[model samples]
Target: MKKLLFLLSLFFVTSLYAQVEKVEPTFWWVGMKNPNLQLLVYGKDISKNQVSINYPGVKITKVNKVANPNYLFIDLSIDSLVAKAGKFNITFLQNNKKFATYQYELKAREQASANREGFNSGDVIYEIMPDRFVNGDTKNDFVKGYPDGTDRLNPDARHGGDIQGIINNLDYISSMGYTALWLTPVVENNASSTSYHGYATTDYYKVDPRHGSNELYKKLAEECKKRNIKLIIDYIVNHSGKDWWIYKDLPSNDWINNYPDMKICNFRGTTVFDPHKAEIDAKGMSDGWFAESMPDLNQRNPFLATYLIQNSIWWIEYAGLSGVRSDTHQYPDKQFVSEWAKQILAEYPHFNMVGEVWLNYPSMTSYWQKDAPNLDKYNSNLPTIMDFPLHNAIPTAFAEGDGWGDTGMNRLYDIFSQDFLMANPMNIMIFGDNHDTSRFYTLIKEDFKVYKLAMAFLLTTRGIPQMYAGTEALMTGVKGSGDGVMRKDFPGGWAEDKVSIFTRQGLTNDQIEALDYMKRIQNWRKSNEAVKYGTMTQFAPQNGVYVYFRIKGDKKVMVILNNNNDKQELQTIRFAECLGNHHSGTDIISGNALNWTNKIEVPTKSAMIIDLN
Candidate 1:
């Protein structure tokens, strides 16, 4: 009798260990062969659970554990499971008592494939801060815990732009000939004020409930792909919001870059590549806070680095993005950054990524590009970078000049001189204004002619062009010295708005002309092969007039910019080499015959493009 009691006690203990409390499943491998499918599962009190998966014409090869202690990884190594995809039931048991049983459905991997097809591409990328673009849906304008509601009336507050709004305006973007869209961080920003920009990430895995959802972003990619438009997600690896989820309950002390206490950075970006830099300076730059609210990430921690890298990969595989735009490029650990870029590119070889190295100097910027000859000889695989050197110079050149120093068109002269540092100039994204700066119109004090001239050069330039939202509409909202006003909502996109550029609802004559001109130039850029991949040559500036030509095998485009207000005329013999033996051509803008000879005439404060056929 005592021996019988001992055996019964052993059986009871085994039964208690195998009884699972609840099974919570997370990621579903949308589409895989029924036989080869691997379903990762998370459960509460499931350590010793007896699990079995059953399906018609399908078999489970094994069950295992993932990195987490509370996971039951289900693996099916069937070769013919793709054809038999439908639904399968699994049961978890303890002794003879059933603990849990549920049906798991197998659906084709539509979302995963969407992410793969939508984001990888070779095209010009336009980055938009959705909240500042247009308000297509105002129903989601307000949420609890955040009092700054939709304020189309306030230029500094939420403008009510959402995913649906972006969807509504796809035609306008597509009409402009842009092949891809890179939106700023759109995850749920639960901050009390100024959360409209969506940069301060509160959660890494969850989409900011305000913008939409993880699924909506996938839908955005799907919508874009149908129209041949790729999506480039703007990612921030440098820091998170002050109240990030991990901040309250970190997995480990080293999970964050500079956790527990915030370390402010010196804003010294050059130190990352400086060979003689002090160890403390480098550490501060990588682990320092961008601002009081922004908590910097410490990528040096192995787990943190791996987590960030895997998260980035998950998004890429999840969203099917055409590319990625890394924010605060120099703030993260440089070694880890190299690994991040390498792993990302390794996963998707055709995918391209551009880093934001907001430096005004080319020498400082070139150190971040891939294969650049560095003092440290670091080989990074990041493919592209923002052209800040050129971006800054264009405005200065168009602005009324000092006639000396880095003034007048010489600003353009000095900026392009550094093009030799770039491995591929075509991949460089050139822009006049972005979400973080004063609008071009505001910067030039709303001068229409200056804005036109600036647009002409930006579209015809040698880099991938990125125009800020509302730039075409001549929207002039300045966000002050800190760039709070640079991003304003599009008129008439919301129900309360009075004007709409799409239908020309409330535009001035000048605004209409500007919008039409932008459409024309952008579409022209999309089709012009010479402009896309041609050799460029420029004649020296004369009285603020700069002339350049993009030449291919037999295709040549002569671009003439007149920053001065006075018009000038001359014979066309100056560009004989580039002009070839042709004596006549057509001005694309004016549609007038151009009698090529010793010199050519250009209008003052105007730009002309000559189509040499």
Candidate 2:
């Protein structure tokens, strides 16, 4: 009889262990704007059991079950006004018999979390691909269970950069006058190869161990906060890695867009706003997978939509993020994107979100911004959209000399003229090049003169400017060489690195000059109110020079770009409306006193930022 009892006990224990496997968002916080919480419970036939919560001030509003018996989405309503931080018991019952119990906790939020400020026009964002930026903790470089390991020699292989590396260099970033740091996604990307980019997310809630733990990521944010630097997470909502848990054991066939067939995306972003676009084309663009390895998420499914929305909010509240850079923003369902932005903004009113809308035209890009006057009457509710139109114009403008309408500075002038279509042009995130494109230095053909000109325009322009990690250090790489070439490791990020730009050691004179020039302009921009939140007045390109003024209440900044191969005299009389009574000013770059009454001599392929005193 004792042996029989022992066998029965063993069977019961095995059944209990098999009941539940995972509970996402392991814990939540009280006092959230939205009291409705959805807890995704994953286990073997866990959906077959009825769930209930007996905790004080917490009620199980509903239990949703999908076609797959392995999943259960439990909705809970926490009384935000009176909910206290404590552990609560969630019981799972099968056939009126207790099978498994989950002890969930609700924590108190940080002070002023809902009112946390996001990165804005007053800030300059320094974009870094963590894997290529630095490797602070070599111990976590090659994690077990992950197929691909670090191989710095191969441009396409992981180079072992981690969150600790970023934390270690917070001082370096802050000293450079950058107010915000935007890292490419650090989420778990357990792909067989090319996982260093961090765009293909395998786990929504966990940071890849190779990058660092989720705790380390939070610590990175805290460290950034101490240095007055905001962290902008590059979030991907359109797709997930093929190895994603949900992809392996989908809750339903509709969990992913294309499912077994895996239709590659059309990548025609313009179809989103094409009024007369065919229904088939629109569906193909939105429903198509980004790649074979990245499965497209079916945001049209309410469960998946809610899951993604909650996951984003969870990260913001958990990590204390300043902002979010939505990857492939237009590829997701239009309505879902609108709702996602609206909900996030509703919770954190001061937060900012910039979407990656890769359209080459200003009008189409403008249509994605919040409150845009779209003829189709769709509101994206997204505060910012990337300035791809300006991005396309920059290289062309610098490459060409003066022309009537389309060449030289006219290219930029024509682009900015359509800023009227945008609800708020200043909110656009402007960058010369990013990880996917050729480096800015290479785009300008490694010409330091043109590089300086591009920097001046980017920093002084009427938008939030972002600079890639090594751009200030004169890093050059062509996109044709592949993305890994563009996102090469930062020199001196590793101890083995012979040359470190982080310090002045082992740098060419041109590199040092570029670094110092960038620092000076960036620091100057930090304190200048006119450049930060001023109204812009740009004059047409004349004699190969593009002149613009950023004027606020009592402050004014005049920027001149001479793109010619020869010196040009900029007439001061034409800028009388902006120059006003100011007879003299100091050039921020050369520290020369300018006589506004006479023509200003601008050198070939040079830029001048004048403080109108």
Candidate 3:
């Protein structure tokens, strides 16, 4: 009898251990605006058990069991009665017998967490792809568990840039006058190969060990705070890497869209807003997988939706991030995307979130912004969007010579004229080029004149400006060749590189000129109120010259883009409405005084930024 009892006890313990395998969000915080918290519990036959929490001011509002016996979505109401910082026990009962017990923690939020300011028009964002930026920690280059390892020679392979690399080079970024650093997703992309871009996330909660630890990411945020630089994390909601733990053992069949047979996405962004679209096409666009290796998540599932929403909030609270850039924002279920944005903004009212809506038309992109006048009553609640239309127009604008109407410099003016469609035009993120596009330097055929013009226009424009890594050094690459070429490692990031643009060593005169010009404009933009919060007035392009002014309060900034092959004298009288009483202005680039009384002479294919005093 004694032996029988002992054996039974051992069996019970073993069964209990296997019953509760994982609890997502491992922990949460108290004092959140939303009292309701949902915890996703995964284990063998976990849903068969009843969950109860005995903590004060916390009540088990609901225990949701889906078709999958391995998962349980436990909802709790954590009111003000709970202690600011403490651990509570969650007991699982099956047939009135204790099945398992787990300890959950509630942490005190950092001061001013909810009020953290996000990146705005006043900020210039420098976007970096970690794996291609710099390799600061050699020790983490080849993490043992992850399938892919570092291979600097292979353009598509991971180059092993880590969080430390970014931390080490914060000074360089700050020196360039960037107020924010937006790195591509740092989440673990434990795929077999081609995982460096970080879009395919295998682990949503943990940072890639090869990049660094979660603590290191938090440290990076802290360091950035000390330098007055915001950190914007790239987040993907549409899909997860095939190797994701949840994908291997899904909580339910509906956890992923089209679970058994992954259907490739149509990549048609218009279906989301297509009033006359077919159901099949819409489903193909939303429910289809991003790639064979990336499984599209079914945000329609309530449990999964809550999980993703909580995950985003958890990261924001955990990492102290200023904002998030949602990757492939339009591919997800439109309603869920709206709810996700709403919840995030509710939690952090001042936090900013920019969605990557890579549509070529202003109408399509504007449809996703919050409060857009869509034909359908859908509001994404997204505060910001990438100005892809403007980005696409810039290269063509610089490439074309003086023309009759809406050509050359006029193309730029035409693009901005569509700003009325945007809910908040200044909130849009404008860029010359990004990691996914052909480098700006290469797009204009390496013409230094056009490059400077593009840069000046990007900085002085009416939206938040973002620049790709190595843009200041005139990095050149064509996306048609492959993304790796465009995302090449930054010089001086590696110790043995022959050229270190970081120190102005081994650089050509043109490269030096480009770097210095960018530095001058960006640094000056950092403190200029006119560029940050000014109202813009543009004149019709004439003789390949485009002129505009940014006026705020007593400050005024006039910009002239001369796209002609020869220097032209721009008639200043045409811009008198913006120039007001200003007769003279100081050129930010050349430090030369400009007499704007009648006309100003601008060099060919160059931009002149004048501070009207």
Candidate 4:
């Protein structure tokens, strides 16, 4: 009879309360720069309970219960200086009776984690769209209830390129002299369609099972470390997938902007900084949903703000990432995103994060960089901004010969004249083409000479250079047909592929030559500090020839682009300012050492790079 009574009591306790459904961050570490931490607790009727933590140096500063009965935002003051790495119970009670208890752990951070350096100008970045890269595992091709599954024939569907795909190709990647790898979002996306892009995130903490588990992602980072490659994650904070757990059951209506009757964003980054802009225009850019499936986040909501910020920190720590590439960076709340960057930098001092400021003009892109002299006194605190202005100008410059206003080489050099608008010009990231655009070869009408000229210019330019995966193979696609065509599968990534770019099997002569040329230049770039860190000096367009010099303390390299149809004799006397006391140099491209006699003959539609002696 006593045993029956004890069993009945145990049943009552077990049935009455379950462990808190979710504790975001699940755990945290001691010795963080910020002593305060906000934990978003989600569970059934969780708001009705009183919360208490029993841990040394861990104090529950405040417990916030929103309109939702299932969500609790608990603020804790973690005195890292005194907090020991251990676990303790966080008890939830109702009517002074314990109902739920969660055991949370505080961990010890990795040594020197705070001092980890981010990707910079010294590194050449290889940008990849993972789903189209390779199929590393077939088992994860179709995750149950994920909506989108592997379909190689369907350009918009997932193709089963897991993190293991990236791990398996580290050799090919590093062999191309790429020091940093930037992949589009690998986070979980449960959207019904076109989920291969990975921008809409359903789960922030978990890597999409379709891509592989979060552990596999960390393993990818570890493998990259073995090969001296830095991993940069493409992170999105502006909005989340409509299927996101938080979006489905919002903690509060304001957690997401324009929740039920959401409006589309104006897609104008200028609205954020336009002094004469209408309030509606500014709000439209910030509050409007990025898309029907991407519900915009309200960073103004302190709880949501803390959630996003903490998530960024969590991923950086958990994955050991070198940097973050924030997608749709200009769409979030102004002041809140500023603070978001502030907090992340406070934790990782030397870290670098580039904003995706996809503006048409340099002024617009520069405005979001770390320090721009804006009339409105706005500072984005973003370490780098994509050089869209230059990327837009390059193909046009290479494709068109001597022409009017900002045409030909003029279009290329004219963009740099606006450099005064940039606080740090070196922080810009330049790319000839990316996943969303037409390939460089396609843009140049498949002119191999022009392709080499354009690539040589981008590689030798003043900013950090990022090359999209298939650029070297001269992959061709036009952007107007849609992103699907623009982001085609990398040849030979799958077993069924007829030809593999990986092994140079059955490649066209142009494709093989382009690949070898890019490999040569990129490998050489790895050793040339002048091109990476030197001050750039450009010469005015002279008869379809553009010249530039990258000069360091005593190191100098000269780049000449001949966009003409005839061989041109470039007078050396005109570049005396850049050629101080040097009469001879080795032309690295041809491996020919030439002694200048006031002029050098450069082939038409070709690039010449000289290492000064």
Candidate 5:
């Protein structure tokens, strides 16, 4: 399947002795839109040598020697149109004579890698924190040289879940009607503590040995492809682990935002777009370190910026990724991210990437989307942004009673009323909860009625929907308890566990009910095109009943939410515009046929997903 099989295995080029310590992206693919390739050559006195490449269609455009003599930024121009999948000898010279030869490779890309269609509205994303999902292999729980280890008893400690764990659960996920999968950062987070989240990247080119190898990660993308599941990788460009290899040996002080005396960030993400914000405040938010263990990257540095951009592209190509979830999207230098996204899109036009814009208002969140018409003329070039505004409104919307003055169902109406402020409303990434937030089940006080209502609205609403892991089994944890509690291990993930979500064993009554409800709606959503790509038509809420219609070419799905206590109805005439000539329909959730001649009786604190006939 590869033009050059040897190209797959990349090692340090040892000509007599090892001179090239690191080269990233370990390997590159030909036919890339960008013809230039900058190889970060690191070794002892490596910059003192002359860089020369003896291969057709590959030329050393410029070899830049940095302040650190061990580092050399070798720029090579590869003619994509003329370059074939082959190897070239990059000969390092001392006094015009070749001393060391490093064999660099340009491999053939997978067919249509550039044209890969990303995860969109049609796919329901099931997000997984790999370390807490399942422990398919316990052998690599504690790899030598990796300081952290797993402790199942401690919520804050690692639970030993790995890539093989996710590979083992693909069928269960696919069977549940989740069409796409998103794994929180699998890049090496070799920190001493709290590294399971994977946001603090240590080695960009290597996968954490405890989690799995790069080979297994590629196998995951391949396996997911076989199951018709699109894979999205969580990426963070704002910072890296404090113990990163490059950090130990600096090419320049500007490589990191704040070097020896690092200042902590205020986390005022709004300052990036705040027109009236003070320059000092903006500097504190952007240039300051996210945490003591994480070093903020200086995107203004051309070499560092290119490293971040190339790393993402390499992952996308190597792992066969469908989409990217840019973590801490608002924390980075806006201009660098814009160019980073621009270069990625330049290479792959159809590729989709969502940013975790953790803003509570649509007006602010919309500013990060690609085509947002901001007065500053700064476009993020991001395809989608997370719906934090709607997420903030959901728990309160379902918890309170109706007609309580913007307290109950009216909360949802108010949020949707501001959709006009969004750049692309349909492209929003909506979710009930994620690894960073409190469990959705815990937020609504474990109310089954509210659970069903939230799930129904999420699946049937506009934009792409993302479900956090273990939501089906009614997983409960508050964010204040610590991130590890909210991202607890699944019952079936460990061998010694009494309950198994896979086999439906040892689950509580409420958990069983929640699982059944989740399975039913998720599986039903797969085949329904109206709910996926259809236009949404929502009627103004009246009497605590919020009604919306998902209408495609000919298919229609009517979703009704009754947030009141008892039963309330007589709403046929109000929805006649979307109901059309159909007088009857079946509720997808209850599987009961209903009449809609004059009025329909709606139950309290429940949702009805009707398929009109």
Candidate 6:
């Protein structure tokens, strides 16, 4: 009887022990890989009071704790480990008990963006603020401490669009013929209400939960590469969100710029180049917070600079992105920004990056472009810059008759004349409207004719063209335009929406025509290598008409835009000389044969593209 009772007790004890299972963390991430393989592992587990890591061959170099209590951080050194594209075994233990083992695969550094050798001069970038683009995943839309998104109907509030949303609509973007896509910052934006824009970054290393997980972001980049679509991530180095991790309890007092007592910048970019300017404005440009909610970063501080540089490199390596577009380019320390670009370009020789200068003057804009002969000698390694000077010219040109500043043709003539100021005029990003202003459609009063004219100029113009997300369908909204209006749910993105552009349902005849027109132009631009890397030459403006030729070797594309109210005739002789003796070709738009030898007639407020094949 005693032996039987003892056996039952032993059976019960074994069963209880089996029921208590150990759980391992779900998501794990590492960054800033050195040859020594220093890594910071971040993960979460339900009941991990203590954690330890184990790996064969590779050394367990260091371990640390992260802010979250559920997370256990581990570091490893792969110095002695040989690299081949294969998996290695790693284990995690808690309190002397085995919890989980992972098969960590190692490979040579992954390719971010495409091989950039021939990439710089040819690609047209389409910049989309991801949160405002689409809401593919509704499950993780609202996160705690961030905005509370109970209503998808409100644009001023969080709208649940995420990285998964962009991934879901890869086909839509690809079909539009855009070779590259640039998304606004996707890092963790924990601020509430207005965080949807993603400019106020609370965490640099983590993707915002409201947007999607880091893994999902990586997947988006991978999927884009498969479609031959390049990804350029927009980064904000000027300031961080008010409630940033470092702001709450900084690793050090100087971890942030002007820590404790926030500072306001003078917003004087000219001072950086001014011969006799006050030191106050120069300091303010580099150290002043963009807004009270955003804290400026001190790039002059070596530690802060190192942290930022490493963070950027980590993302490029991790996601394999094609390029980077720096936000508020002139706001940071000019010297530091130069070094930042230098370090990144050194690591990625073929990589291309463009900074947002937002300067409407040609001289101010040209100062940032690489190799520009600026009197200040600001040798910024950055290769490309946003061409606001050209952007400013387009609207005034298309708006009414050619008066004082209203001459539509004069805008282009005046702006292009200053092209000598640019280091590489072909590399400038030319666009009509962006997130900060009213939509192009709203700006032009929803006129398709005017819109198409703008499109023609952008597509055939001398710079890398970037069309804002809704520019195709004429998406419009005023800034502070209430977030909902700025990023209206895509026509057919949501199941509840009445129209879906994807299926061509619920679109009017004109809307459908406009859509088709965009599709045609984008597709045409994709294969025209001459337009991508061609040299442009222009003839002096004549009677409100402007003509230019994009030529590469034997291939030539002549663009003639007539902004006048009445049809104008070109004497053919003048443009003939600019075309290098070619007198006849086919009109790309109408498919009509062109008689460029004797004379050329262009309709009022219309443009013609001729493929001189």
**CA error at residue 454 for candidate 1, angstroms:** 1.2
Better model by lDDT: candidate 3 vs candidate 5: 3
Angstrom error of the Cα, residue 337, model 5: value is: 0.8
TM-score of decoy 5? 0.96
Q: Ten consecutive residues with minimal summed lDDT in candidate 5?
A: 8-17
The whole-model C-alpha lDDT of candidate 6 against the native structure comes to 0.74
Q: Which pairs, if any, clash in model 3?
A: none
Candidate 6, TM-score vs. the true structure? 0.84
Task: Give the per-residue lDDT of model 4 (tens digit) for 100-173.
Answer: 88888998998999999999898999999989899899899998888788888887777778788889999999
Report lDDT per candidate.
Answer: 0.73, 0.91, 0.90, 0.89, 0.89, 0.74
lDDT by residue (1-613, candidate 6, tens digit) is 9999999978865543343232222212222134333333333442353434444445666555544444333445554344344466455556766555455565455434324442365776777877666778877765666655636667667666678878998998999888898998899877766777788888787898878888888999889988899888888777788878656644346556777788877778777677888887777777777888898887876646756776777677678888999999999888888888887787677888899997769988888977778787778888999888787777777876565653667778789888888888988888888877677887777877888888888888888888888678766676565545766656776667787777778877777877887788778888887788899998767677789989888888999888777898888767656676776788767778876566888888888988886
Error of 5 at 216 (Å): 0.5
Give lDDT tens digits, candidate 2, residues 181-272.
99999999999999999988989999999989989999999999998899999998899999998899999999898878889999878889
400: Cα error in model 6, Å: 3.4
TM-score, structure 3 vs. true: 0.96
Which ten contiguous residues of candidate 4 have the minimum total lDDT?
12-21
Cα-based TM-score, every candidate: 0.83, 0.97, 0.96, 0.97, 0.96, 0.84
Q: Write the per-residue lDDT of candidate 1 for residues 45-162, one digit (tens) a residue.
A: 4545667766654567777653444556566554444335467667777795666665665444544343253232125566788887766666678877767687765755777788
- Summed backbone clashes in each candidate are 27, 0, 0, 0, 0, 11
Error of 6 at 230 (Å): 0.5
Best by lDDT: 2
Pull out the clashing pairs in model 2. Answer: none
Cα lDDT of model 5 by residue, 129-232, tens digit: 99999999999998898888988887877889999999998999998889899999888988888898898888999999989999999999999999999999
